[model samples]
Target: MKITLDRVNENFHFKLKNERGHIVDVDSRAEFGGSDLGASPMELVLMGVAGCSAIDMISILKKQRQEITSFRAEVEGERVQVGEAKPFKDIHIVFYLEGPINEDKAVRAAQLSFEKYCSVSKTLEPTATIHYKVVLNNKSL
Candidate 1:
């Protein structure tokens, strides 16, 4: 599990490649002289948290024998204005799951992710508090 970054421009733009040779374009925000090329590093980090936990939830629910028709996550990171290092103060992840899924199972899956399964969220725990919610069939659980 290793990745490398190759500078693509004089500015903050760069190409990130994983060990599998998968590519992800990364760039700083325009305010930092980036050309709006790709996602800012912070944005990608937050996205990683979302993706990691979502995968965990899906796996957990599937093992619980729940049928999942559609699922998406909305993740938000609140960062503190620290000079040159604006780390997130907290992160909130909301999962929208549509299917014949049991509400309790859905909630439990999310809980399992935040409490034990999601590695990315656990990594950020020291620097940021993580919050989670599950919405099933348009109702918050």
Candidate 2:
């Protein structure tokens, strides 16, 4: 559960590597004197929430024998000024699932993820309010 970061340039650009050797490029926005080369740290936090929840939901569905065709999630966060830094005040996620899945199961899976399963959301729960909605086969559930 360790990672490393190396400067990619003189500015705020960096390359992050997980213990498994996976790489994620990181950088600040152009307005922050970065090269706009990769996702910012805050952006990665949102991505982490999305990815963590997606994995939980998918695992739940798979165990329930649901046939999933595709899945995608869109995450948005609102930031509030906290001293000299801006932190997320609220985070919203929209999960789009395509499959011959049961609607009730999908909804329950999402509920379980936010309320119990997703660790990333839980980590941010104390500071940020997290909300999510599920859309299954173009229908909101």
Candidate 3:
């Protein structure tokens, strides 16, 4: 896929456009002259991972005939440096599943999704240590 980034100002503010023509604004604290309404590139990458895994887990659970009342994914990451060459050293995803879900099945689904299905997880595997946990109805799965 292709994406375009246009400068919004002399600072780090920019507008990003994807192949589908969707546009998003991105700016840094130094560029935006503030701390609100913008996501750093690193934050966006973590979001991508969360989104990818959430989608896959939900789909897998649904196909398995699990009654899901609620689902949430919490993603956290650690940065190793401050330059363009810097990378996220580690990432963690906590999948919370509610409503009559099987713990073993949920955990297996998450593991399979990260290991073989989620594109973002697969792509980041080479760069960072990706860890995950599954919680079903407030209990560790």
Each model's lDDT: 0.92, 0.96, 0.86
The TM-score measured for candidate 3 stands at: 0.88
Q: lDDT by residue for model 3 over 1-141, one digit each (tens)?
A: 899999876677788999998988777775437443478887889999999988888899899999999999898998787575779889988988899988888998898898889998889888799999998999986
Off by over 4 Å in 2: none
Per-residue CA lDDT of model 2 for 24-120, tens digit only, reads 9999899989999999999999999999999999999999999999999999999999999999999999999999999999999999999999999
Name the candidate that leads on lDDT. 2
Error of 3 at 18 (Å): 1.8
Model 3 local distance difference test score: 0.86
Measured with C-alpha atoms, the lDDT of residue 108 in candidate 2 is 94
The true-versus-predicted C-alpha distance at residue 136 of model 1, in Å, is: 0.2
lDDT of 2 at 135: 98
Worst 10 residues of 2 by lDDT: 8-17
Q: Which numbered prediction scores highest in TM-score against the true structure?
A: 2
Preferred candidate (TM-score higher): 2 or 3: 2
Rate residue 27 of model 3 by lDDT.
71
Question: Count of backbone clashes for each model?
Answer: 0, 0, 0
- Per-residue lDDT value at 21 in model 3: 88
